[model samples]
Target: MEIKLVKAIPGDVLLLHDVQTRAFQPLLEKYLDYEKNPANEPINRLFEKIQYSSFFKMVVDQKCVGGIRIVARNNSYWISPIFVLPEFQGKGIAQQAICQVEEIFTKHNIWELQTILEEQGNCYLYEKLGYERTDFEQVVNDRMTLVGYRKIKN
Candidate 1:
Protein backbone atom coordinates (compact mmCIF):
# COMPACT_ATOMS: atom_id res chain seq x y z
CA MET A 1 0.00 0.00 0.00
CA GLU A 2 1.19 3.50 -0.77
CA ILE A 3 1.41 5.94 2.13
CA LYS A 4 2.30 9.60 2.39
CA LEU A 5 2.67 11.90 5.37
CA VAL A 6 1.39 15.39 4.71
CA LYS A 7 0.62 18.60 6.50
CA ALA A 8 -3.01 18.47 7.66
CA ILE A 9 -5.50 20.40 5.58
CA PRO A 10 -8.52 22.28 6.84
CA GLY A 11 -10.82 19.72 5.25
CA ASP A 12 -8.97 16.88 6.96
CA VAL A 13 -9.85 17.92 10.47
CA LEU A 14 -13.23 16.27 10.54
CA LEU A 15 -11.76 13.10 9.12
CA LEU A 16 -9.07 13.09 11.78
CA HIS A 17 -11.69 13.63 14.42
CA ASP A 18 -13.56 10.57 13.28
CA VAL A 19 -10.42 8.46 13.08
CA GLN A 20 -9.33 9.52 16.57
CA THR A 21 -12.69 8.97 18.19
CA ARG A 22 -13.00 5.53 16.62
CA ALA A 23 -9.39 4.46 16.96
CA PHE A 24 -9.39 5.44 20.60
CA GLN A 25 -12.95 4.51 21.48
CA PRO A 26 -12.09 1.41 23.46
CA LEU A 27 -9.50 3.18 25.59
CA LEU A 28 -11.40 6.41 26.01
CA GLU A 29 -14.64 4.68 26.92
CA LYS A 30 -12.96 3.46 30.07
CA TYR A 31 -11.12 6.66 30.91
CA LEU A 32 -12.69 9.83 29.66
CA ASP A 33 -15.83 11.76 30.47
CA TYR A 34 -15.99 12.82 26.86
CA GLU A 35 -16.72 9.22 26.03
CA LYS A 36 -19.93 9.54 27.98
CA ASN A 37 -20.87 12.64 26.06
CA PRO A 38 -19.28 12.61 22.61
CA ALA A 39 -21.72 15.24 21.48
CA ASN A 40 -20.17 17.89 23.72
CA GLU A 41 -17.06 18.97 21.79
CA PRO A 42 -17.67 20.64 18.50
CA ILE A 43 -15.62 19.20 15.68
CA ASN A 44 -14.31 22.70 15.07
CA ARG A 45 -12.95 22.89 18.59
CA LEU A 46 -11.01 19.68 18.04
CA PHE A 47 -9.76 21.06 14.77
CA GLU A 48 -8.70 24.34 16.31
CA LYS A 49 -6.77 22.64 19.10
CA ILE A 50 -4.94 20.40 16.65
CA GLN A 51 -4.31 23.31 14.31
CA TYR A 52 -2.66 25.29 17.08
CA SER A 53 -0.17 22.56 17.89
CA SER A 54 3.36 23.23 16.59
CA PHE A 55 3.71 19.65 15.32
CA PHE A 56 0.63 18.20 13.74
CA LYS A 57 0.88 15.68 10.92
CA MET A 58 -1.42 13.31 9.12
CA VAL A 59 -0.93 10.19 7.01
CA VAL A 60 -3.10 9.79 4.00
CA ASP A 61 -3.73 7.44 1.15
CA GLN A 62 -6.85 8.80 -0.50
CA LYS A 63 -7.76 10.42 2.83
CA CYS A 64 -6.39 10.58 6.33
CA VAL A 65 -5.85 7.06 7.72
CA GLY A 66 -3.81 8.14 10.74
CA GLY A 67 -2.16 11.15 12.39
CA ILE A 68 -0.10 12.40 15.33
CA ARG A 69 0.16 15.66 17.28
CA ILE A 70 3.34 16.83 18.98
CA VAL A 71 4.29 19.65 21.31
CA ALA A 72 7.72 20.87 22.36
CA ARG A 73 8.32 21.43 26.04
CA ASN A 74 11.52 21.46 28.08
CA ASN A 75 13.59 20.39 25.06
CA SER A 76 11.46 17.28 24.55
CA TYR A 77 8.70 16.63 22.06
CA TRP A 78 5.47 15.25 23.50
CA ILE A 79 3.39 13.07 21.21
CA SER A 80 -0.30 12.93 21.94
CA PRO A 81 -3.23 11.07 20.44
CA ILE A 82 -1.41 9.19 17.73
CA PHE A 83 -4.09 7.20 15.99
CA VAL A 84 -4.65 5.00 12.97
CA LEU A 85 -8.11 4.03 11.83
CA PRO A 86 -9.21 0.73 13.39
CA GLU A 87 -9.44 -0.90 9.99
CA PHE A 88 -5.86 0.15 9.24
CA GLN A 89 -4.22 -1.06 12.41
CA GLY A 90 -1.28 -3.55 12.04
CA LYS A 91 -0.68 -2.26 8.53
CA GLY A 92 2.30 -0.23 9.72
CA ILE A 93 0.39 3.05 9.37
CA ALA A 94 1.18 4.06 12.92
CA GLN A 95 4.85 3.10 12.68
CA GLN A 96 5.23 5.16 9.53
CA ALA A 97 3.44 8.13 11.06
CA ILE A 98 5.73 8.05 14.09
CA CYS A 99 8.82 7.90 11.89
CA GLN A 100 7.62 10.83 9.82
CA VAL A 101 6.94 12.91 12.91
CA GLU A 102 10.32 12.02 14.36
CA GLU A 103 12.02 13.14 11.16
CA ILE A 104 10.53 16.59 11.57
CA PHE A 105 11.53 16.72 15.22
CA THR A 106 15.08 15.68 14.37
CA LYS A 107 15.40 18.36 11.72
CA HIS A 108 14.57 20.93 14.37
CA ASN A 109 17.27 19.52 16.69
CA ILE A 110 14.56 18.11 18.93
CA TRP A 111 16.11 14.79 19.86
CA GLU A 112 13.93 13.74 22.74
CA LEU A 113 10.46 12.29 22.19
CA GLN A 114 7.89 11.65 24.90
CA THR A 115 4.58 9.80 25.00
CA ILE A 116 2.29 7.87 27.32
CA LEU A 117 0.52 4.62 26.57
CA GLU A 118 -1.80 2.30 28.51
CA GLU A 119 -1.02 -1.00 26.86
CA GLN A 120 2.03 -3.21 26.97
CA GLY A 121 2.01 -3.71 23.22
CA ASN A 122 2.11 0.02 22.69
CA CYS A 123 5.03 0.21 25.08
CA TYR A 124 6.71 -2.62 23.22
CA LEU A 125 6.44 -0.73 19.95
CA TYR A 126 8.13 2.31 21.45
CA GLU A 127 10.78 0.16 23.10
CA LYS A 128 11.56 -1.51 19.79
CA LEU A 129 11.98 1.97 18.38
CA GLY A 130 14.42 2.83 21.19
CA TYR A 131 12.20 4.60 23.69
CA GLU A 132 12.98 4.19 27.39
CA ARG A 133 10.43 4.00 30.15
CA THR A 134 10.97 6.60 32.88
CA ASP A 135 9.01 4.39 35.33
CA PHE A 136 6.40 7.09 35.63
CA GLU A 137 2.76 6.15 35.85
CA GLN A 138 -0.40 8.11 36.36
CA VAL A 139 -3.95 6.98 36.88
CA VAL A 140 -6.57 8.81 34.95
CA ASN A 141 -10.33 8.37 35.33
CA ASP A 142 -9.43 6.17 38.29
CA ARG A 143 -9.71 3.21 35.95
CA MET A 144 -6.91 3.61 33.40
CA THR A 145 -3.14 3.72 33.61
CA LEU A 146 -0.70 5.88 31.70
CA VAL A 147 2.88 4.73 31.18
CA GLY A 148 5.38 7.32 30.03
CA TYR A 149 8.26 6.90 27.62
CA ARG A 150 11.06 9.03 26.21
CA LYS A 151 13.33 8.60 23.22
CA ILE A 152 16.62 10.46 23.14
CA LYS A 153 17.55 9.72 19.55
CA ASN A 154 16.34 8.26 16.31
Candidate 2:
Protein backbone atom coordinates (compact mmCIF):
# COMPACT_ATOMS: atom_id res chain seq x y z
CA MET A 1 0.00 0.00 0.00
CA GLU A 2 2.59 2.49 -1.09
CA ILE A 3 0.94 5.88 -1.67
CA LYS A 4 2.71 8.36 -3.88
CA LEU A 5 2.03 11.77 -5.36
CA VAL A 6 3.33 12.22 -8.88
CA LYS A 7 3.37 15.55 -10.61
CA ALA A 8 0.70 15.45 -13.28
CA ILE A 9 1.51 16.29 -16.85
CA PRO A 10 -0.67 17.75 -19.59
CA GLY A 11 -1.11 14.37 -21.24
CA ASP A 12 -2.62 13.06 -18.04
CA VAL A 13 -5.52 15.52 -18.10
CA LEU A 14 -8.11 13.11 -19.48
CA LEU A 15 -7.32 10.42 -16.95
CA LEU A 16 -7.14 12.90 -14.08
CA HIS A 17 -10.47 14.42 -15.11
CA ASP A 18 -12.06 10.99 -15.16
CA VAL A 19 -10.74 10.21 -11.69
CA GLN A 20 -11.86 13.61 -10.41
CA THR A 21 -15.34 13.07 -11.82
CA ARG A 22 -15.67 9.67 -10.23
CA ALA A 23 -14.31 10.86 -6.92
CA PHE A 24 -16.57 13.89 -6.69
CA GLN A 25 -19.73 12.49 -8.28
CA PRO A 26 -21.32 11.22 -5.07
CA LEU A 27 -20.81 14.53 -3.30
CA LEU A 28 -22.17 16.43 -6.27
CA GLU A 29 -25.27 14.29 -6.36
CA LYS A 30 -25.83 14.66 -2.62
CA TYR A 31 -25.19 18.39 -2.45
CA LEU A 32 -26.42 19.35 -5.93
CA ASP A 33 -23.56 21.81 -6.10
CA TYR A 34 -23.88 22.12 -9.83
CA GLU A 35 -21.82 25.27 -10.18
CA LYS A 36 -18.91 24.27 -7.97
CA ASN A 37 -18.61 20.52 -8.35
CA PRO A 38 -15.48 19.33 -10.05
CA ALA A 39 -17.54 16.46 -11.39
CA ASN A 40 -19.20 18.93 -13.75
CA GLU A 41 -15.96 20.60 -14.86
CA PRO A 42 -14.81 20.16 -18.43
CA ILE A 43 -11.66 18.34 -19.40
CA ASN A 44 -10.27 21.59 -20.81
CA ARG A 45 -10.65 23.20 -17.42
CA LEU A 46 -8.64 20.41 -15.81
CA PHE A 47 -6.02 20.74 -18.51
CA GLU A 48 -5.74 24.41 -17.73
CA LYS A 49 -5.46 23.66 -14.05
CA ILE A 50 -2.58 21.34 -14.72
CA GLN A 51 -0.75 24.18 -16.37
CA TYR A 52 -1.10 26.61 -13.50
CA SER A 53 -1.43 24.58 -10.32
CA SER A 54 0.66 21.88 -8.74
CA PHE A 55 -1.61 19.06 -9.79
CA PHE A 56 -0.51 15.65 -8.58
CA LYS A 57 -1.81 12.20 -9.29
CA MET A 58 -2.60 10.18 -6.20
CA VAL A 59 -0.96 6.94 -7.05
CA VAL A 60 -1.13 3.77 -5.02
CA ASP A 61 0.88 0.77 -6.10
CA GLN A 62 1.47 2.44 -9.44
CA LYS A 63 -2.23 3.03 -10.14
CA CYS A 64 -3.78 6.45 -10.38
CA VAL A 65 -6.49 6.51 -7.72
CA GLY A 66 -7.13 10.27 -7.56
CA GLY A 67 -5.54 13.72 -7.52
CA ILE A 68 -4.79 16.82 -5.46
CA ARG A 69 -4.59 20.38 -6.78
CA ILE A 70 -2.44 22.96 -5.01
CA VAL A 71 -1.94 26.66 -5.52
CA ALA A 72 1.01 28.42 -3.94
CA ARG A 73 1.80 32.03 -3.16
CA ASN A 74 4.91 33.08 -1.29
CA ASN A 75 4.96 31.13 1.98
CA SER A 76 1.36 30.03 1.71
CA TYR A 77 -0.27 27.16 -0.15
CA TRP A 78 -3.87 26.40 -0.98
CA ILE A 79 -5.27 22.94 -1.49
CA SER A 80 -8.30 23.56 -3.66
CA PRO A 81 -9.34 20.01 -4.42
CA ILE A 82 -8.24 16.64 -3.22
CA PHE A 83 -10.08 13.47 -3.97
CA VAL A 84 -9.86 9.70 -4.08
CA LEU A 85 -12.02 7.37 -6.12
CA PRO A 86 -15.13 6.00 -4.41
CA GLU A 87 -13.61 2.59 -4.14
CA PHE A 88 -10.38 4.07 -2.81
CA GLN A 89 -11.81 6.32 -0.14
CA GLY A 90 -11.30 5.52 3.56
CA LYS A 91 -8.05 3.73 2.85
CA GLY A 92 -6.02 6.68 4.26
CA ILE A 93 -4.79 7.55 0.78
CA ALA A 94 -5.98 11.13 0.94
CA GLN A 95 -4.41 11.64 4.33
CA GLN A 96 -1.06 10.36 3.16
CA ALA A 97 -1.32 12.41 -0.01
CA ILE A 98 -1.90 15.60 1.93
CA CYS A 99 1.04 14.90 4.17
CA GLN A 100 3.26 14.17 1.22
CA VAL A 101 2.21 17.36 -0.56
CA GLU A 102 2.97 19.41 2.51
CA GLU A 103 6.37 17.76 2.81
CA ILE A 104 7.08 18.45 -0.84
CA PHE A 105 6.42 22.11 -0.29
CA THR A 106 8.73 22.36 2.67
CA LYS A 107 9.07 26.09 2.44
CA HIS A 108 5.38 26.70 2.80
CA ASN A 109 4.33 27.66 6.30
CA ILE A 110 0.64 28.35 5.75
CA TRP A 111 -1.73 25.82 4.25
CA GLU A 112 -5.39 26.37 3.59
CA LEU A 113 -8.38 24.53 2.14
CA GLN A 114 -12.16 24.47 2.09
CA THR A 115 -14.78 21.78 2.45
CA ILE A 116 -18.53 21.51 2.79
CA LEU A 117 -19.56 22.64 6.25
CA GLU A 118 -22.33 20.10 6.37
CA GLU A 119 -19.99 17.20 5.79
CA GLN A 120 -18.78 16.31 9.23
CA GLY A 121 -16.47 13.61 7.94
CA ASN A 122 -14.72 16.05 5.65
CA CYS A 123 -14.44 18.62 8.41
CA TYR A 124 -13.19 15.99 10.80
CA LEU A 125 -10.51 14.80 8.44
CA TYR A 126 -9.13 18.30 7.99
CA GLU A 127 -9.33 18.97 11.69
CA LYS A 128 -7.59 15.70 12.48
CA LEU A 129 -4.81 16.77 10.17
CA GLY A 130 -4.22 19.98 12.17
CA TYR A 131 -6.34 22.30 10.05
CA GLU A 132 -8.33 24.79 12.08
CA ARG A 133 -11.62 26.14 10.84
CA THR A 134 -11.49 29.78 9.86
CA ASP A 135 -14.35 32.18 10.47
CA PHE A 136 -14.90 32.34 6.73
CA GLU A 137 -17.94 30.55 5.35
CA GLN A 138 -19.62 30.68 2.00
CA VAL A 139 -23.27 29.72 1.67
CA VAL A 140 -23.50 27.61 -1.41
CA ASN A 141 -27.21 26.95 -1.09
CA ASP A 142 -29.92 26.36 1.42
CA ARG A 143 -28.53 22.94 2.12
CA MET A 144 -24.82 23.46 1.73
CA THR A 145 -22.15 25.79 3.04
CA LEU A 146 -18.43 25.91 2.40
CA VAL A 147 -16.09 26.52 5.31
CA GLY A 148 -12.49 27.56 5.20
CA TYR A 149 -9.62 26.04 7.16
CA ARG A 150 -6.02 26.86 7.66
CA LYS A 151 -2.89 25.36 9.24
CA ILE A 152 0.20 27.29 10.06
CA LYS A 153 3.47 25.59 10.83
CA ASN A 154 5.90 27.22 13.19
Candidate 3:
Protein backbone atom coordinates (compact mmCIF):
# COMPACT_ATOMS: atom_id res chain seq x y z
CA MET A 1 0.00 0.00 0.00
CA GLU A 2 2.93 2.29 -0.73
CA ILE A 3 4.64 2.52 2.63
CA LYS A 4 7.47 4.95 3.20
CA LEU A 5 9.40 6.50 6.10
CA VAL A 6 9.52 10.24 6.32
CA LYS A 7 11.69 12.21 8.69
CA ALA A 8 9.83 14.05 11.41
CA ILE A 9 9.16 17.71 10.78
CA PRO A 10 8.16 20.57 13.03
CA GLY A 11 4.73 20.40 11.44
CA ASP A 12 4.17 16.81 12.54
CA VAL A 13 4.32 17.38 16.29
CA LEU A 14 0.58 17.53 16.74
CA LEU A 15 -0.11 14.56 14.47
CA LEU A 16 2.43 12.48 16.33
CA HIS A 17 0.91 13.53 19.61
CA ASP A 18 -2.51 12.45 18.42
CA VAL A 19 -1.21 9.14 17.21
CA GLN A 20 0.58 8.55 20.49
CA THR A 21 -2.51 9.35 22.49
CA ARG A 22 -4.83 7.21 20.39
CA ALA A 23 -2.50 4.25 20.23
CA PHE A 24 -1.86 4.15 23.97
CA GLN A 25 -5.21 5.15 25.37
CA PRO A 26 -6.57 1.70 26.08
CA LEU A 27 -3.32 0.36 27.38
CA LEU A 28 -2.82 3.32 29.68
CA GLU A 29 -6.30 3.04 31.13
CA LYS A 30 -5.88 -0.67 31.70
CA TYR A 31 -2.38 -0.60 33.06
CA LEU A 32 -1.62 2.79 34.51
CA ASP A 33 -4.88 4.54 35.27
CA TYR A 34 -3.85 7.01 32.64
CA GLU A 35 -6.67 9.17 31.34
CA LYS A 36 -5.12 10.90 28.37
CA ASN A 37 -3.57 13.68 30.36
CA PRO A 38 -2.43 16.32 27.89
CA ALA A 39 0.16 17.74 30.24
CA ASN A 40 1.93 14.43 30.73
CA GLU A 41 5.65 14.85 31.16
CA PRO A 42 6.43 11.75 29.16
CA ILE A 43 4.58 13.13 26.15
CA ASN A 44 6.36 16.40 26.62
CA ARG A 45 9.63 14.55 26.82
CA LEU A 46 8.79 12.73 23.60
CA PHE A 47 8.23 16.00 21.83
CA GLU A 48 11.42 17.52 23.15
CA LYS A 49 13.43 14.44 22.30
CA ILE A 50 12.08 14.17 18.79
CA GLN A 51 13.67 17.44 17.88
CA TYR A 52 17.13 15.87 18.11
CA SER A 53 16.45 12.19 17.57
CA SER A 54 16.05 10.11 14.44
CA PHE A 55 12.28 10.21 14.34
CA PHE A 56 10.20 9.02 11.43
CA LYS A 57 6.57 8.57 10.62
CA MET A 58 5.35 5.85 8.32
CA VAL A 59 3.07 7.13 5.63
CA VAL A 60 0.75 4.94 3.62
CA ASP A 61 -1.40 6.27 0.81
CA GLN A 62 -0.48 9.82 1.84
CA LYS A 63 -1.58 9.38 5.45
CA CYS A 64 0.49 8.82 8.54
CA VAL A 65 -0.25 5.21 9.31
CA GLY A 66 2.48 4.56 11.86
CA GLY A 67 5.59 6.00 13.46
CA ILE A 68 8.81 5.02 15.24
CA ARG A 69 11.41 6.66 17.46
CA ILE A 70 14.96 5.49 17.04
CA VAL A 71 17.81 6.87 19.08
CA ALA A 72 21.52 6.40 18.70
CA ARG A 73 23.27 5.47 21.91
CA ASN A 74 26.60 3.84 22.64
CA ASN A 75 27.12 3.13 18.95
CA SER A 76 23.85 1.21 18.74
CA TYR A 77 20.31 2.19 17.90
CA TRP A 78 17.30 1.63 20.08
CA ILE A 79 13.80 1.84 18.63
CA SER A 80 10.83 2.64 20.77
CA PRO A 81 7.19 3.63 20.79
CA ILE A 82 6.43 2.21 17.39
CA PHE A 83 2.76 2.66 16.81
CA VAL A 84 0.21 1.82 14.14
CA LEU A 85 -3.39 2.94 14.39
CA PRO A 86 -5.81 0.29 15.68
CA GLU A 87 -7.65 0.18 12.38
CA PHE A 88 -4.32 -0.26 10.62
CA GLN A 89 -3.11 -3.11 12.80
CA GLY A 90 -2.30 -6.57 11.37
CA LYS A 91 -1.47 -4.99 8.04
CA GLY A 92 2.34 -5.12 8.43
CA ILE A 93 2.70 -1.37 8.93
CA ALA A 94 4.64 -1.74 12.19
CA GLN A 95 6.90 -4.31 10.63
CA GLN A 96 7.63 -2.05 7.69
CA ALA A 97 8.59 0.77 10.03
CA ILE A 98 10.87 -1.54 11.97
CA CYS A 99 12.44 -2.99 8.85
CA GLN A 100 13.12 0.50 7.62
CA VAL A 101 14.82 1.29 10.91
CA GLU A 102 16.91 -1.85 10.63
CA GLU A 103 18.05 -0.78 7.19
CA ILE A 104 19.08 2.59 8.55
CA PHE A 105 20.79 1.00 11.52
CA THR A 106 22.76 -1.32 9.29
CA LYS A 107 23.69 1.45 6.89
CA HIS A 108 25.00 3.54 9.76
CA ASN A 109 26.98 0.66 11.28
CA ILE A 110 24.77 0.35 14.31
CA TRP A 111 25.44 -3.02 15.91
CA GLU A 112 22.50 -3.41 18.24
CA LEU A 113 18.88 -2.49 18.63
CA GLN A 114 16.53 -2.72 21.58
CA THR A 115 12.94 -2.03 22.60
CA ILE A 116 10.48 -2.77 25.33
CA LEU A 117 7.12 -4.45 24.81
CA GLU A 118 4.55 -4.12 27.56
CA GLU A 119 2.24 -6.84 26.34
CA GLN A 120 2.71 -10.56 25.82
CA GLY A 121 1.39 -10.56 22.27
CA ASN A 122 3.72 -7.73 21.40
CA CYS A 123 6.59 -9.67 22.94
CA TYR A 124 5.82 -12.51 20.56
CA LEU A 125 5.71 -10.08 17.68
CA TYR A 126 9.17 -8.81 18.59
CA GLU A 127 10.46 -12.36 18.86
CA LYS A 128 9.09 -13.19 15.45
CA LEU A 129 10.84 -10.13 14.12
CA GLY A 130 14.21 -11.49 15.37
CA TYR A 131 14.39 -9.76 18.74
CA GLU A 132 15.47 -11.90 21.67
CA ARG A 133 13.69 -11.31 24.91
CA THR A 134 16.16 -10.73 27.69
CA ASP A 135 13.98 -10.15 30.71
CA PHE A 136 10.55 -9.15 31.92
CA GLU A 137 9.25 -7.18 34.87
CA GLN A 138 5.83 -7.01 36.39
CA VAL A 139 4.30 -3.64 37.04
CA VAL A 140 3.22 -3.22 40.65
CA ASN A 141 -0.07 -1.48 39.97
CA ASP A 142 -1.31 -3.45 37.05
CA ARG A 143 -1.75 -6.92 35.64
CA MET A 144 0.52 -6.02 32.77
CA THR A 145 4.28 -6.52 32.53
CA LEU A 146 7.15 -5.14 30.53
CA VAL A 147 9.43 -7.19 28.28
CA GLY A 148 12.79 -6.12 27.01
CA TYR A 149 14.22 -7.35 23.74
CA ARG A 150 17.36 -6.80 21.76
CA LYS A 151 18.75 -7.70 18.37
CA ILE A 152 22.29 -7.58 17.11
CA LYS A 153 22.42 -5.73 13.85
CA ASN A 154 23.35 -7.86 10.89
Estimate TM-scores for all models.
0.78, 0.96, 0.82
lDDT of 3 by residue, 78-127 (tens): 77667777788778888778877887766445423333345666766677
lDDT for predicted candidate 2 compared with the true structure: 0.92
Query: Sorted on TM-score, highest at the top, how do the candidates line up?
Result: 2, 3, 1
* Runs off by more than 4 Å, candidate 1: 30-42, 54-57, 107-118
Top lDDT prediction, candidate number? 2
Root-mean-square deviation (CA) per prediction: 3.3, 1.0, 3.2
**Candidate 1: tens digits of C-alpha lDDT, residues 1-154:** 5567777666777777777677777655655646432324478876776678753445554677766777776767777667676788777777777777787676444334334365666777788877778777765556566667777763
Question: What is the RMSD, in Å, between candidate 3 and the native fold over all Cα?
Answer: 3.2
Which window of ten consecutive residues has the lowest lDDT sum in model 2? 99-108
lDDT of 2 at 70: 90
Give lDDT per model, in order: 0.66, 0.92, 0.69
Candidate 1, position 50, lDDT: 66
List the candidate 2 regions with Cα displacement exceeding 4 Å.
none
lDDT of 3 at 93: 82
